[model samples]
Target: MSNCSGESNMSDVLKLAQKFNCFYLSGFRTSECKPFIVQGFQVGLIRPDVIKQLLSFPEVFHFNQDCVELNPAFRDYDTRSVKVDEVLKELKTKNVFMTLKGWRDECYEVKTQFDTPSLLKMDRSATCLFGIRNYGVTINGFVRHPEQGQCLWFQKRSASKQTWPGKWDSMVSGGLSVGHGIFETVYKEAMEEASVPDNLLKNLKSAGCVSFYFESERGLFPNTEFVFDLELPIDFIPVCSDAEVECFEILPITECLRKILSQDYKTTNAPVVLDFLVRHGVVTPENEPDYIKIIELLHVPLQTIYWHRNKIKENGFGANEIQGSQ
Candidate 1:
């Protein structure tokens, strides 16, 4: 309900953008987390508490003093996924932590980079436990209005949603779950979330991505949002097909920027919106002094941070290389 303490003193959009990226800013202490190594690659970062919890399952998680790795004996992807799922199900049943309670049946592919093969698949809710770098798609739906200049669409999330209930967000946004490519996710989320049809979606234009690291009570989130700009016809009105969205409203660019920086908007959604703003010339270096810094925050180096953490072994793997994933 209230903005960050003394946040009112922050006058520029760059300061507001920094609030969502504390994971790479003032928040993270590399000393407190262990690199979540899997298949000889540094894939995620696990906190000490989570490492301690995983240590209980020695058969599933092999370890050294520096990092915790998925047991090399699993041999292949299916075995690794099933084995890890077994442990997660046990943890969920045991109520190991609060993140397990909101478990969505959805699975997010865990990989060293977006192009790499999955090392394993984990329940979307539990990926944060390993500080996985998750990816999602965000569509910036906007229109060129005669009277209002340029207006962007915003959606009020359903009150029943698991996270960020009843908050204002981008028109069509959904996670990049396993088996879905970036372009495929755009088509799917556009129709499912906003009921925007194929003919309209044909105009979808890729505006690149926004990546950041954010942590909450749920856990660490190193997320990248593949952003797209969909220009809607003036007569087009978006209807929510999937019940994920409560309602949709069109706001002028100024109002959209205000809501994005306000307390009511979903913080995670702000980076993509800010990216849209900066890309469209709404926020500029002449107007916002920290333009370059915001650009850096929007693209955190999540993919490489893991391997570099605490000076991993120069021999290519962490301390020890697991023999399975090729």
Candidate 2:
């Protein structure tokens, strides 16, 4: 076994585990010399070979015979290995695991078994679960004018936030608090982020809903977003909330699509809304490469039903009528 200088941090251990793509079993006591498998060798017993392997990998700080005890940070990881045939099957089904880069440096913690349910409420920490996390509702709407065609609206996200800070995004997008419904969340975000009134939002059309699982260099954010559409009068001016929106623009949809496709736009959330719009035929696919890439990555369907569409149709009403009924 490699002799530990008796001084190593959890970060060092995590780097080793990630490099080897190995499982880090935690919650083990140091008292027992449990014989466990380490690098295919039966170690922690009388066997010196296993100890040698463990020592060679300096990242492994604690070990026992039954299992190697790692830092708790890697406890809830998705590190299942697949055979070549299984990999092929996954690729065929479009269920391939895309590698997430840059998480090694981020601060992470193992969700204690007891804290799993409550911790899952937070957007950043929730993705560790096998289930999905409710980040927020994403509203996609249009500001129209008689002469200028439809102008797209986007909001600049707060710079103080952890993910996608200081970037432009959908007009009104935010996380749902613990007790709020999807509609209530969207309504609240629209009013807070754009100064849009609830009465005006009553006319917001339910375009569709999309569930996305994305893990990039930043972090994993699995979102079930409800897309809404609204048509405003040409002269309708949106007052920007400095906290949520840096400024408001009235660019034509064509210009918006161009900037987005070229990656010239600083908005991270715009591509998602644009992808939904393109799938619904609101925006042409020919000029939406960024949106197309997003659809491909998430494997979202070309078109889907708005979560509230059935109820609206059942009541024999449009968006305005449904709002009135509510």
Regions more than 4 Å wrong, model 1: 1-12, 315-326
lDDT of 1 by residue, 171-224 (tens): 999998988888998898888888898999989999899889888888889999
Clashing residue pair totals per candidate (backbone < 3 A): 0, 7
TM-score quality measure for candidate 2? 0.50
Taking the tens digit of each residue's C-alpha lDDT, what string does model 2 give over 66-159?
A: 3443323323233211121232233324422222221222212222221233221222232222112334577766776567776777666666
Tell how far residue 245 is off in model 2, in angstroms.
Answer: 2.0
Lowest summed-lDDT stretch of 10 residues in model 2?
Answer: 20-29
Give the top-scoring candidate (lDDT).
1
Question: What is the Cα root-mean-square deviation between model 2 and the actual structure?
Answer: 19.4
Task: Return the clash pairs for model 2, or none.
Answer: 1-51, 2-55, 34-65, 34-66, 35-65, 36-65, 145-234
Estimate every model's Cα lDDT from 0 to 1.
0.85, 0.44
